[model samples]
Structure formats: structure tokens, C-alpha cells
Target: MSDSSFSGFVQSFKKLAVDTLSIREGSDPEATIEGIKKDMTFKGHAAWILIFSILIASIGLNSNSPAVIIGAMLISPLMGPILGIGTAIGIHDVDMMRRALKNIAIAVVISLVTSTLYFSISPITIEQSEILARTKPTILDVFVAMFGGFSGIIAGSRKEKSNVIPGVAIATALMPPLCTAGFGLATGTYKFFFGAFYLFFINSVFITLSTYIVVKYLRFPIKKFIDRSKYRRYRSLLIIFLTIIVMPSGVIFMNMIQETRFKIAVDNFINDNTVFQGSELLTQKIVYTDTLSTIDLYYMGKNIDENKIIFLNEMLARYGLNAKAGEYFPLTKKTLVRIHQEDGSGADIDKKFAEYSNDLHSKLLRDIYTKNDEVIRDKDLKIKLLEKRIYNLNASKKDPYPVQQLNKELKFQYPEVEKYAITSIQLQEFEGDSLKVIKHPVLLVKLSDTVTDEQRPEYLGKIEKWIRIRLNDPKLKVYKF
Candidate 1:
């Protein structure tokens, strides 16, 4: 390529860069300031809008609805005062700064108050995941707030209004934290109040700082205040705020890292120090929130003091989880076993073995005895039930049926027969005065009132034969009633 052609290409790229990067070119600072002031005034319509937006956000958080939260963010007037504060600080406008601070205070108080009232009245008391998520602020929130503030001012300075402001509101998420803080207030869970409020504070402060930086970068004309010492306090207050907000956020981030590291260390310790080869590590419960960290491991065939206990103490120190020498060993008792170990002090081991063996033997004997008793009881119950069944069968056989299904069938077949009954008889007699009896099952049937009167004897004979055939006893007896 020719040098002239290369220079022309470079110039074209530079022009593109300048055109893309220039924010002040199309921006009117005075118009932007007036627009922000109009937005920053929190009274009448703005106050009502803020109040309603807070309620919507509270409902969203309570119901775990992300879409509702986004709607609330879009309608929220919170970004107005926050951006106003940022702009005021950026341009060194003391009057605007005072107004911005006052308006922001009003918005915050109203937001917190409105949300608190709504949450208190709401029937859904359980903390939803959406609300719970906002309670824990991370470093990511810092970036969101800063970027949102920066973009907000850039968009505000433009000649044509865009969707960027609403997008920033949703991205910064000012409403959710306030609603979450309200939840904490309603439920008496002060941690939620502190954590969520801190998140909101972080978003607001960083956003204001970003606006200040952007305005300063744009080199907009600064407002000269009449009282220098009074305005100086504002700068001092900003510094104080930076210390307060940044310190806690940094501390929380560090604690989160520590907690995560503690979990990994615990997991590694368990995986590496399984008591024996074929032993399974079932589950572990580790609490590392407070100064004293605890780990409870559930497993079988693992000896505590040999490797586990000593190793756990070492891990706590290695991972900075605050392990004590003798007091804070991981496991105190075996998870699934009750027997004492034979730790090879000859006599002591023997004594422990003896006790464990005796206990095992006693338990085995008790179980065997209990099982035997159950089996015996079951057999007795079965015998009683069987005897009762036999008695019922005998009784049923001897007595005639009170309402006979067979008689109904017979009556249907032979409608001339008015009534019918059959009783089982044991055919028995004394043989040659020997006082002994022989017996056979014979069905004795009685019939009465034939419908045709002309066939009584004939019907009786037919019925007797039918009864004998049906009973499977040719020796069945027939009688008239």
C-alpha cells in the first residue's frame, strides 16, 4: 500500500472513532440540566408515581414475579433523583445538589414506607427467591449501578429520548432492594433490611459517582457556589460515603469467597480422607458462617481420630476456617455404627471388644426372642381362627337356611311349590345295641302348598328326586309340611 493511501485509511478510522465516542457533540448541557431538575422534583405526580411503583415492586418480590418487577422498574421515579444527584455533583451545582439530596431522601423514605405498608398487609409472608436474591449484594451490583448511572446521563444529554433510561432502571434494580428491605421490616428479619438497603445504597452512590465522573469528563461549566465552606462539606460527605459503602461491599465479597473456599476444602478433605477403601462418604453438613466452623460427616467404617479428626483440624487451619486443637475435631460419634473401636491399648482394646460383643450378643438375643414370640402369637391366632371356621361350617350344615337361595331357584323352576326348606341330617343309629352309631350326610327336604292343588303328590315326588340329585346324596329324605 502507498503511504498516502495508508494515512487516508487511518484518518477514516479516526473519524469513525470520534463520531462513535462523542457524547457531548449532540448534548445540550443546559437543556439536560433543566430536564434533570424537572425529573428530580419529588412532589405531587412524582411522589405518587414513586409510591405506586414501590407497591408494584413489593408485590413482584412477594410473588416471585420477574416480569412484574421489570414493569415496576420501568415506572419507578427512583432513577430521577439518583441521576439528578450524580449530575449535581458532576457540575458542582450546590443548589442542584441540595435539591437532588432532598428529593432523593423523599423518594427513599416514601419508597421504604410504601413497600413496608404493602408487605405488612400482604398475605404472602414467605420470602420468595426473587426477593431473597436481592438481599445478598455482590461486586456485580457495583458495576451495574455505575454503568447504569453513566448510560443514564449519556442518554439524558441526547436530543432525542430513547429506551436507555428505562433499561438502566431495570439493570440497576433500585426498586427490588427497597422492596426487599420493606419485606425485612415487615417480617422482623433485620438482616434482610440491612443487606437489601445496603444494595440500594450501593447502586445509588455508585450511580451518582459515575454521573459526576461523566460530567467532569465532558468538561461542562461548573456552578460557582456563594458559600465555599458549606459546599466543601458535600465533598467531605461524598468521601465518607465512599468509605462506608465500599468497605462493607468489599468485606461481604471477601466473606463470600471465604465461605466458598471453606466448602471446597471440606469437600476435598472428605474425598481424600475416606477411612477405608470400600467405605462410602454418604453426606456432609458444614456450617462456616460464624467464627467457629463445624463439619459433620456421615459415613461407615471410617475411624475418626486416626486420619479424619487430625486431618479435619489441619484443613480448618489450612483453609482459614478456625479449627481448635482437641475440641473441634470433625466427628464425635460414628454416623451409622454404635460399637467402640479397638484402638490397640491391649487391655483397653480387650475391654472395649468384650463390652461391644456382649452388647451385640444381647441385642441379637433380644431380636430372636421378639421374632419367636411374634411367630408363636401368629400361629396361635391362626389355630383359633381355623377352629372358629370349622364350628361355623358344622353349625351351618345342621340348621336349615332361613332364606334359601336354592329354594328360590326351585320355586322359580316349579312355581306350583309355595314353600321349601332343607336340613342336613347325619344318618346314624345304634348297631345291635352296641351303643355305637354310623353316620352319613343326607339332605331332608320339606315341601308344602302347591299352586295347582292337583299335582301335590307328583310335585313332591319330583322335588324329592331333584333334591337328592342336587345334594349328590341318593339317600336324601323328603317330607310334606
Candidate 2:
């Protein structure tokens, strides 16, 4: 293509794009705004559209359904008045601006009231992550609203066909804020209401400003407006100036303070806990999930003595942390003992166990199960072998057996005898008793809080040996978990 042809094509595209987006500035901007208000079928069409969209949004918020919320946003007629306001302000149309403001206020109040009423009567009390997530506003949110509004106006005012309106709807997220307003009402939370309303306010202001700029760029006739009053023009200028100068700075300052506080807390935690030499600090997750606060500190590597842990606890207590931390010790990594048994009973079992156990070494390393890459589930053959062990354990009531108190905290895969017999048994409290015969041989085991399925055998072996001595039956057979 020739240079002139390419230049002409570029000019044509620019003109088309400009004409599509720009609403021309006029002399009597107020009169133009009033004309728009008069033409808006508010009571008949716009009212119903607004109500329907708000209703959809309310339901989406209650259900925590993103798809439903997006649908509501797409159909919302509320954006029209907001854009009108922006357009009016940009071209100094005070009357249209006032009317648009009134409409927006009414729309917000109606949406909030209706949503609140619906949520209050609804039986759903579970607050979903989606609903909670939207309640907080940050600098990122402000930026999103501003850019989204800009894009929305550009897409909406275009003459040539494009699905830009939907994009605008998504970017603005008009429905969620209203739904959040409803959630506040339902839960009777002033914080929710405040945050949501502020978000709505931001979006409305940004959208209007964007629309006003676009309209001015389009050269909408200012002199053709209906409400040609001097006072209206002054009011429009004041509002437009204040919005341009004040809001963005305030939002930025608030976000900065919040981020600074969060960083301080994280840094303090890391600095305070760096003294433990043997233990490898895994993670410190400061999660803001529920309204309530919590901090989770995960530690891996070697176990220090109880004295060190107590000292650490004292340090944490200074920070007002009272939660009890848990500890875990894996035998393969933390201990020196390891025993392997051969399957054939006729073979030299003791010799084999000693030989296999002699190869064991203890290294200060993280437990394999704690890592993300570990696959710890038993194979089908192993599961079947375990089943066979339970089936093969044959001891009857005639055999001398021990009566031991079971811990109430432990849940058994098989039906626990305590569940059937000891309704008032104390949790974690076991009482030694006289030996008693059982229908079948039973295995007794103790569980550490952090033990995975793979580590069960070593711990169970000790328990099984203890139980054997307590029963006074060397021949009594049982499978340990």
C-alpha cells in the first residue's frame, strides 16, 4: 500500500473511534442534561430494569454465585444515569448533572434496601469467601474502578457494533457492591455497609467523570441544553473540580497505611523467631479469612528440647499469642531406632531385624510427609495384607488378656468397645486395670498429632509390645496400626 493510502486509513479509524465515543460539549450543558432526564422513561422502563437487575444481584450475593452476579451487572440500567451525570459535569450541564445524581442516589438506596430486606429474611447464615472478599477495598480496587469506568464509557458511546458494554459491566462490578450492601443489612454490620457504599461511591464518581470527558471530547453542543441557569453551572464546576482533586489521593493514602501495618507485623514475626538453630522455619501464614484474626507458624527440621520450646513460647506470649504450638518427631529422621522383620517366621527373625536396624541413620531433615511431593497412601496389596493381619489374629475369651482404658480422643476404624460400653469415659485419660479375656486379640496404639499413615508402624510396634507384656500372653497375636 502507498504511504498516502495508509495515512488516510489511519485518519479514518481515528475519526470513527472518536465519533463513536465522544459526546460533544455544548454551551447550555444544563439544558442538555435536563433534556436527557425528560427523555428517560424512568417510571415505566428504566425503573423496572433497575429493580430486576438489583434483584438478580441480591440473589447472587446471597448465594455467592459469580455467574449470577455477572448476569445482573450486564442487565443493570443504573450505569446510564451515572454516565449521564459524568457527561453533564464534563460539559458543565448542571441540570442534567443534578438529575443524574438524584437518579443514582435513588438507585443506590433502592438496591441497598431491597437487598438488605431479602438477606434479613433468608435462612442462609453461611458467609461465603466471595462475599467476604468483596467487602474490603484497596488501592487496586480504586484503580480497577477508574480504568473500568473509562473503558465502559468508551465502549458504550461507540456507534459501530461491538460487545464493549458487557466488558464495561464486568470491569465496573456494579452488582457486587450493592449485594455487599445487602449483606451488611442482613448481618447488621455497619463496617460492611460503610465499605460497600464507599466502593459504590468510587465507581459512580469515576464512571461519571470518564463519561463527562468522553462527551466533552465529542463536542456535544453545550448551548443546546435545556436548563440554562448560572447557579447550576457553578455547582457543576465545583463538584467536577472536587472529584478530580480529592478522592484519588484519599484512597491512595488509606491503602498505603494499611499495607504498611501488614508489613510491620510480618517483619516483626520473622525477626523475633530467627533464634532456633536446629529447626527450619517452614511458613508463617497470616490469613485474614474470618472476621476473627489468627496466625499459623509451621516449623520443620529437628526438634529442640522442651526448654527451648518453653522459651519460644514465652517470647510469643509477649506478642499476646497464647495458642499452644504442636510438635512432631519422625523416627527415621529424629530417632536412632529402626527394625525390619522378615515375613517367614521359620527364618532367623531377630538376626534379620538387627541387621536391617543397624543400617539406620538419623539426619536433621524435614519429615517426608510434610513436603508437598510426598504420596503416602498405601497400595492395594499393603491394604489387603493389613486386612489379613487383623483376620489372622485369633485369640478367644479363654486366653488371658488385659483390660485397658481407651482414650476418648482417638477414633477407631473398627467399632470401639469404649463407644458401646464407656459412655462417660474421660478424654485422653486411661486407667490401668486387671487382665481380662477378649473375643479376639486387639492392638493398642498411641498417635501423635502430626504422624502420617506411613509413620504408624514404628509407633504401633512399641504399643503392641507393651500390650503383649500387659496381657501376659506371648502367643497372643495382633496387628498394630
Candidate 3:
């Protein structure tokens, strides 16, 4: 382990690292500049491509289709001017920076105008999910723009550029914000216009700034302005430009994080606390600002009382998301509601009426159900009694009281009949589409002495008519044996 060998090992390791990680500017400087300048040009073809891309992106955002959005991103010429601006700043070329800026302005104006015109007559005014997703620029969007810019510059500087440029274009999402802004303008909503444009501005500025950092780090030969003061002035301007671009986004990201935390905490609180049995939370809204922080929830089903609501409020305080100034009491100016409640707005009146109508309908159904049960019970009792009586009559059917009465009447009247019997006949009757077995009374009579047909007929007729009247069935027929 002599000094020479140790130094040799160290140098060898350094060489290996450099070979693995080194990114050289192999493309000729003049050739590279020429290529960038070509892209930076605001030509007719570039303008048409940007316009068509704007229309495609606007339609995609309007429909909330991610695939269409990616297609638009791949075909967009918007990235050229933006990258040109970054490359100019990276090499400290003021004239190139000016040209890039001018081209970028043209691209932006064309994009905005094209999208606005498309949205104006397209008849789809409703904002889609994709459109809304671009309205807010978060800290994550900042990171994405920075990384995309870094990748774009690295790929562009290489002698043979790969598909990384297209990937950066899609990941950075440069076109969507402009188109979303157009939708907002068409719909007469300044909120969308401002928010989306802010996001687009962030992407463009950060991408340019990232490219400048890379170029400076790579130590690309500076343009070397005749006036050193001009170089310092441009450097200072770039710093100020980045600072101004990033500050608002930082504040916005912090607010977004706070809002996200509030939403998560509120959702957990609502789900964990059983404010009412079978209660369902329909909506939760939070208004978080320096002066005011409040959570409003809308729910349906069984409502929780004030005491339980107060307990739930205490839970919100535990999460450090809510601060209470006074005790909550119902019918007071300030109160906390853990269930279906209103702030005395006119909208609550309609809600109350709907609730009242639902209650009335439920009560009416309950009453009808009770009446139906009583009617069914009474009818069941009558059927049971009739079945019991029929069973007893059928058991003594051979010589029942009705048979004895018939015999006594026949013997006292003419003494022509000897024996008589009563039996039931079960016959299948077709009632509508159904076949039913029905039970009916049948009388069988036997004469003691020999009698002619005419005399037999007279006796049978008299007995059958009498039995028919007693049985209350005039359709009864008699048989002589």
C-alpha cells in the first residue's frame, strides 16, 4: 500500500465514475444553435400545429379523456419555444432569450385563442375531471416541471435525441393549462382562467429555469457579451424571475396540504363517530383561511342530539382542526350540529318539508300495515271456526241429528220410506282457470214395500224437495234404492 498504488486506485475509481456518469456536449455548437433557432422560429407550420394541438387538447379536457390529452401532448409544438427559452438562459445568450420569449408569447396567444374559439362553439360547457385536475398547481406539479425541464435539456443536448423529449412534454403537461384557461374564458368563469394560466406559467418558467441551471452546471461556453454589466444584469433578472415564479406556488402548496389534512381528519371523524345509528354523511365542506376555519357536514337518517354533537366537536378540537369559542347549545346563535341541520337559510325550508313528507309517508304505510294485519287475523278466526264445525258434522255423518229429523218427518207423513242415509259428495268444479273440489250433501233412500214406478217417483220427489228446503240448496237430487 504505497502512495503511488493508492493514488492509482483512486484515479482509477474516479475514471470509472466519470465514464459511467458523464454527459458530453458532442453535437457541434453551431449545429446545436441552428437546430434550436429553427425550433424557436414562429413559422406558419409551427403556428398551425400549435393551433390544431390546442383544439385537440381543449376537446380532450372538455371530455375528460386522458388518452386524448396524451395524444395532444405528443403532437404539440408548444415545447419547442419553451425549451428554446431555457437553452438561451442556460448559455447566457440574451438575443436568443429574446427570440425565444417572442416565439413563446406567440405560441401562448395562439393556443389561448384557438382553445377559446373551439370552446365557444363546441356546446360542451360542463367542466370535466381532466380540466379540473389542471386548475390547481401543487408542489408536486413544481417538481414535475423541474424534472421534465432537466430531462428535456439533457435529451436535447445529446447528439442523438431519444423519445425522452415527448415523454417530458407529456409529463410536464404544457398544453392542458392553456386550453383549460380557454374553457374558463368561454364559460365566463375567471377562477378557472386564472388558476389554469397560473399553472401553465409555472410549468414554463420552471422548465426554463431548470435548463439554465443545467447549462450553467455543464459549463457550456458562455456567449461572452462585450459588457460584463449586461451579463450580471441578465443573471440577476433570471434569479428574480425564478423567485417571483416560485413564491406564490409555495404558498399555494402549503394551503393545499393544509386543506388535504383537514379533509382527511374530517372524514375520519365523521366515519369513526356513530353520531346516529344508520346515519349517512352525504357531503363535507371546509372553508380554511387565516381568520375562519369551519367544517360543514350534511347528513340524512337518524339525527344526533346536541350533547352528542358537542362530544363530536370535542373530537374535532382533539385533531387541532377546530376551535370553539363557546359552549354549543341548540336554538342559540352559534351551535354545532352533528346531524341533519340547517343554518336558517331558505334552502333548509325545502329540506325540512321533504323530511316531513317522508315521515308522513312512512307513518301512513305503518298504519295501513296494521289495519291489514287486523283484517287478516279476523278472517283467519272465522275460517278456523267454520273448519271445526265442518269437522264435527263430518264425524257423525252416518246418523246425525239432521238424518234423524228427516226420518221422523218421513215416518210421520206417509210411512212409505224404510231407511235413509246422508253422505257428502266431493266433485271437482272448474272455476275460471282453476279446478276446485267442492263438498255437497247427498240423500239416499230405500222403500220397504214394492211400489210401481209412478208411485216411487211421487215419494222421491216429495222427499227430495223437503231435503232441498232443509239443506237450503234447491239443486239437491234424490236417489231411490
Tens-place lDDT per residue, model 3, 29-126, is: 44556677788776888888888888889889978789999999998887787877877866768898899999999988888899989888664566
| TM-score for each of the candidates | 0.59, 0.49, 0.64
List, in order, the clash count of every candidate structure: 0, 23, 0
CA lDDT of every candidate: 0.72, 0.57, 0.73
How do these models rank on lDDT, best leading?
A: 3, 1, 2
Model 2 ranges off by over 4 Å: 1-41, 224-481
Model 3 has an lDDT value of: 0.73
Provide the clash count, candidate 2. 23
Misplaced by over 4 Å in model 3 are 1-10, 25-27, 92-94, 219-221, 224-230, 278-290, 323-338, 341-481
Pick by TM-score: which candidate is best?
3
Report the candidate with higher TM-score, 1 versus 2. Answer: 1
- RMSDs, each prediction? 23.7, 19.5, 28.6
Off by over 4 Å in 1: 1-15, 221-237, 274-282, 298-481
Query: In candidate 1, which residue pairs clash?
Result: none
**Per-residue lDDT of candidate 2, residues 315-422 (tens digit):** 543442332235131111110111121233333423434455533221111222233311212222233444443333322233233222232222333222222221
